[model samples]
Target: MPLFRSPTRCIPVALSVTLSLAVLSTTVAAQGVRTADPRASLKGGVKDAQQAIKHLELVSSTPKVEGWFNPRDLGDFGFANSDLAFQKHLVFQGGWHGWQAWDISDPKAPKRRAAVVCQGGQGDPSVYGNLLFVSVEDGGGRLDCGTQGVSDTVSAARFMGVRIFDISNLDAPKQIAAVQTCRGSHTHTLVTDPKDKANVYVYVQGTGGVRSPNELAGCVRSPDDTSTALFRIEVIKVPLASPQDAKVVNMPRIFADASGKVAGLWKGGDHGRGTQNSDRTDQCHDITAYPDIGLAAGACSGNGILLDISNPANPKRIDEVIDPNFAYWHSATFSNDGQTVLFTDEWGGGTQARCRATDKPEWGADAIFTLDVNRKLKPAGSYKLPAAQGSTENCVAHNGSLIPVPGRDIMAQAWYQGGISVFDFTNPAKPQEIAYFDRGPIDPSRITLAGFWSVYWYNGHLIGSEIARGLDIFTLQPSEFLSKNEIDAAKLITRDELNAQLQTKIVWPAHFSVARAYVDQLQRDKGLSESRISAVRGALDAAEQSSGGPRRTALTALATSLVQDVAASGDAVKVRLLSGVVRELAK
Candidate 1:
């Protein structure tokens, strides 16, 4: 009498019904496994109606961390495909459809100031004061900034170079100059010369086809052409007083071999391993320059290089390393202390789901290395997104920057559709994820080449340049892993401007927030006993309240006791750091 038949039912009618259902279920299961439609095998349903079904939505630390999405819609332009630049209260969002200026004074409610309609390649932008530089490397780009596009290969209208703009007026950004190169500036790094205040330098790294001489003079495509710019990176000097006169000042052959020929560069081979083959080192994909230290880490096509940028105009390669696991050396990020560099490998070229369940964990991941006293790089280990993405997703390491968390080395990186993964790499040998933000696949049925291209921390907020979703702003929230005091300490470390490629050392003030950050870290690591932690906190609180002599005496006594305990516990590093803080308090 039941509405549906049960297998255990004694009725004859129920037994027949259950038998029929079991046969139907077996047939459906068999059909599903060997289905001809690829979409049928996908995680989500492939029907047009399933497109609206969201698998993963905005996931974060609630009110502590907030996000704002501004979809890309610059008339009829394409995807928002590259790096970002910040200046004052404005965030410049770049895309193939040109670029847009957003007023992020209120990160929660970002307002668009201006949107330029000029078509170009992946418009990777960098800002300095009132000057803004955008890289254009596609054949379709036009010199006139016209959307009509360029078809003739040798047309004078073709523009494949670094375009400089005077953004003094955000509403009307005027193109000041266009410095064309042999290839084109796929991405460029901004460098400042402390000795020379008159001009700044732009290391133009071209990673595309060589332009014809008819389009731009002095462009020789052949490697045999000794006069060609093919083997070297173009360095453009932009005069602060005369912005229009920005031109290529030097073409340093950093890749040249001992024989004076650019040999031994990656030659595109599997190197006898089952790993993906490396790309030929034609030009650098990205460069992270620490002007203060006069050092630069170049993520070339196949080689990861360390350069001496003492002379801003001519950077010389000091050390280079190759990894079998790396397919393409995509980008590099320096640790806050400058003792370590994390280089990313773009295994699938940012278009395929490299984080799939079957993909190797170390393929499209970050390679951490430590620098010895001689500036030689020593490989440590690797870190990748822990989440296994669906086949209909494009997930790989794209771009990221350090999250200035005082004593720790934490990074917020973009993993294409894998979303933003924040991890702690304080110990290069073992890196672990701390926080993350990801969305469902753009297409449930077919793979869609869309997601975050770059996620960088500028000032206080983590801004991400989404390829298809547009600009996304995120703020860190307090969790069991990260305390409010630590977040406050990170926010205290601010910058006047930020470019992900330009690495800067982060220094925190000797404030209570900083002391609490260290305390939080100690608690998380279980480095100190509960009683010791309480004593340390009590001493810090008392020292903050007291003034002059009393504060100094209390801090020094606490530091001496902590040092002795650390010595006994085999924690010399912690003792040194605590002693340094005590000295700061004394002053």
Candidate 2:
């Protein structure tokens, strides 16, 4: 399968970033600060609302397919869109019903390939080659993909776990396995062991209550029951040769202490005066596994944890941290280098207006931490949408992914009705917003529960999974904070598959645009002398116009000069990166 935009990716183009940046900067660690900023007050409607965008352009706005939604009640909880996963040119979108495979081969206009309708509140989906797994936690879920749900308190017809489907035939997928757990899977991470090829593992997070003994056979209602499905995560092993035999292999107590107390983490309570009461560290809401780095970040109820996953089936807790301002640790994202982690606090449960004029900036925001040589997480900084939203709008930090900008830690995040915010966290202590795209509320009279649940950068577009509206695709435009060279360089780093929670290493090819992106960064921050910057750009432009031999010779010379500038430049790390890219291009 050829790439979507590879035919002319290396062509010569204009690259400029000389404008002074007015980054959206503010100390997000402050509390009890408010102002009548009057944001999100534009015109509103279900489909036709005023949009506020900065350094971003919407390429397409696709609505839900026929029979998939009810227009009369757009905010219907039973039909809300959830998370997303990508493989090749297809995006599998999960919802309350089931999952839909979207053909983004032509990204401007996505087409629906196939659909599955199973009655579950959140069918969080993950894809690995021809295998597709959808989570089932709602008690109404059934074995068959039936629209009518099960009403019995305990019935044999109910299905509550992870469902594996053979999606080799997208037109008619077949259920391969239904691995049951004490509590159903709210979300699961697809993890691959570097040393194992015959099987893959899934770290299942069951946040819902446990099932009855009659329904699942191993679940109890008592909170103090030793066998209760809490304070631990279920690990399921799926053999590639026989996926039908997938079952629970281990339930590691990732939240236990040195003495092996299952409930060793924080109990539900407030920290001090005027603080919010946090939930106990019983079940994890989400887990992000970076197999390439042998580490995983767990966003448990009351604590943010780090796990050593050298053994995929048996992950051990290595470290944990807590934030006084965080009410509930909802999700986690790691930097590309695996040196830092960003955790989100889903305050107000992501449905209330947590970004109001009187709300504290540190309440429902992102807490960033840097990892030391000992793998301990130290507080770095915090970031929140530095804007006030209407009371009727539901806004807070939700799901987001790191944009593959070379030499920078940039992210495009979702904030419910507050909109999508793209920020730069290269300096974790001073994360700043670079771009954003927001829409007015669905209805101004009352809350509509319509906003972007998550936004991710895939191939070259920022695709968003909106709760009320359908899919939205956007491309980051060049501005003072970002350059065309940097955006093009990011596009060079493509992936065959993307399960955002299961992060993989990002590798850029030996391309001239990659080198230019680094050069543009130096110019933006004044890291190098003006004369040196001009000379480097001229050399790159000249080399790009010449043939193979001349281009190599010119690039080699430029690389030698870059190596010398590293000692004198203000940003030694960026200079080193630029020199490395130039050397790779010469080779």
Candidate 3:
């Protein structure tokens, strides 16, 4: 996760009267209003035919050299409409190394103002006040939360959990204090209570770390430890001056009801480990707090969790939502109105969870879902990426925002191959794509490989984290046409129905033996042992056993070869394999 970027980041300013005069000058120039001017007319009203919304404007794109941690998420303070002297900056995790800040005052051009490198570099980041609290997944390679194969030689500095940085100064953000309290910090959010200043708190969710040898049966001291009960979401009250005041609070005692029996503890410590309301199911990946609602939502890997933080010192776990469809929830954000919670699944990047190829976007298993906290954390709706574009090895919408753009109804989302998409979620159940900017020259087929990590609307400007590149900024060009039917009928269909339709539409070529030969050569050349090679061969055989066996097998072989090629030779694989592992698994 050590990407080519820096860390921790934000700001305010004014020459008093001079700033006021400058703001007045700009406002007077903009015809007296602060917001972007509305279009004059809707020339062609809504019609029976669907109108295409086109993408306009490429503000700026920077190619990151020594990338920071993988840019996991992005956020803006008041850079949109306010006349803050130095517009708010963008705060993101530089891969796993630390936090990186960028100055985006000029929408057309952005400057990388600062980078804050800290220990335990991997995890999601969130900003509050002048402090940037990052939930670092640094457990000293001690826990096997899932990355069992990650090299043990990576330093502990890369695994220190919850490194607090003082980002008050934009130029040289300092790591004032470091806390190794949790086993591993997945993601944390700062909860600021306007009602009581003493109530401000930080919630850090630690997805259970590497299981101990005693816990995981038949497992040695490897990374894949499932038995360790270290997974928990912590509520620590913070003092304005020192992070040392951070202390864990008591959580609702939740226990795992395995087979109707109280078997284990909830994942989030006393919240119940191996039980019905266990927050530790897949490990807490994100903790989003809406202080306005006195609520803190945890995006557990396989489940969604909600907690009432009215009493920050001792939070209460109220309800939990579990959807088996998505197994890995990466990030969570509340809507502007603070009624709806949005969760993004990080499933499409060619891992076991999302095994699709890049071009075949159907297999790209990422999804955008909303839960209504106002109604007891009930799931309000969900919208998955349409499967018509084929499957992608690693494409899916990642960290995004419910933009405040008037009449746009667009939620700016970071799609790997899709680049950045502004979708009309006017109808929450069905989202319409209004505009999209695909990353230049990147294989669209491999859409889940962390191409664009985060996308957020900062005022009029749309900021995106292009993982392969650096930060990208864009301006939304208002479109005159209104598309009523951008929502595909296919997307509304049930998974079974979609699969039924795909059975006929997802056909492969009659012959791919030539490509198969090349794959064999590669396996041999790579010196894969007989057993490992057989494992691959077994995959091909297993795929071949499905309905579209021949096609699926050939596609699997091709994709496997392609991924191996890309990993080994750094060559782009342009192959599409919708009917491969994804379709086969669906069957």
Computed on alpha carbons, the lDDT of every model, listed in order, comes to: 0.73, 0.83, 0.43
Per-residue lDDT of model 1, residues 1-587, tens digit only: 00010000000111232332333233223322212222223333212212211111232211101122223321112544467888878888777778888888877677778777666677889999989899888778888889788877588888888999898888788998998887887788988888899998999988887887877788888877677667679999999999899999888988887677874466656544354576667678888899888899998877888899999898988888776667788889999888999988887777777787677665777778888899987776577776677787778777999988877889999987777788888887667667877666766767766667888887878888777656778888887767888888888877778887887668788777877787767767776777787888898899989998899899878777777767554345655676677767667
Model 1 TM-score? Answer: 0.86
335-434 in candidate 3: lDDT tens per residue? 5454555665554321221322222221122233344434454443444343212233235546666544322235767655344656665444445566
Q: Across residues 1-587, which tens digit of lDDT does each residue of candidate 2 receive?
A: 00011000000011111110011113464322334333546577777888888899999989987678877888777888888999999999998868899999887899999888877668888999889988888888888878788988888888888999999999998998998887888889999999999999998998788888988887776768777777788999999999999999999988877897788887877665655567788888889999999999988877889999999999998888776667788889999999989998888777777888788777788888888899987777778887778888888888999999999999999998989999998888788888988888888888877799899999999999988888999999999999999999988878889886899999888788898898899998999988999999999899889869898999899999889998999999999998998888888
Q: Which pairs of residues have clashing backbones in candidate 1? A: none
TM-score of candidate 3 on Cα atoms, chains taken together = 0.57
1 or 3, greater by lDDT: 1
Better of 1 and 3 by TM-score: 1
**By TM-score, how accurate is candidate 2?**
0.94
Off by over 4 Å in 1: 1-77
Worst 10 residues of 1 by lDDT: 1-10
Candidate ranking under lDDT, highest first, comes to 2, 1, 3
